[model samples]
Target: MTTPVEVRYFAAAAEAAGRGAEQVLLPAGTTVGGLLDLLAERHGPALRDVAARCALLVDGVLHRDRDAPVGAPTRVDVLPPFAGG
Candidate 1:
């Protein structure tokens, strides 16, 4: 089955994705890395480059581990490194 996930892109990630947010239908039990891969394929290489250094905020929790599995009806924030304190 497919799970619906809300993906929000910020800063450089937003620029790469050309949008601030989107709803993606992902396979059940999809890993963080898998999601990133799918996004790269959908958005192209620019997003791939930014996503490599980006951090994922899953359901309000910060996640850096790519192997982590994402659950359904989740909100994923793609955050790129920012300047300033």
Candidate 2:
């Protein structure tokens, strides 16, 4: 059965998404890249690039690649590079 995935955004990413997080239902065996596309379509182009470079975390573990496998009820966080003093 398909499971719901939680997409979290931080910093500018959050602003682009217009919220801190969202819950989406994804088909089984969805890849990280696919999820990013879904988020970009929902958020917009500006957020799409950020989402592409942003780190992905599944169940609190950092995903290594875009092809990484993601399952239902997954926790995905979009983290943009931080430049602060």
Worst 10 residues of 1 by lDDT: 65-74
Q: Judged by TM-score, which candidate is best?
A: 1
The local lDDT score (0 to 100) that residue 17 gets in candidate 2 is 90
Judge candidate 2 at residue 84 and give its lDDT: 57
Residue 42 of model 2, lDDT score: 92
Candidate 2: 10-residue stretch with minimal lDDT: 76-85
Alpha carbon lDDT of residue 15, candidate 1?
97
Model-by-model lDDT, in order?
0.89, 0.80
In terms of TM-score, how similar is model 2 to the real structure? 0.85
Tens-digit lDDT track for model 2 on 44-82? Answer: 998897886687777887775888777664577778777
Which residue runs of candidate 2 sit more than 4 Å off their true CA positions? none
Q: Which pairs clash in model 2?
A: 4-73
Per-model TM against the reference:
0.92, 0.85
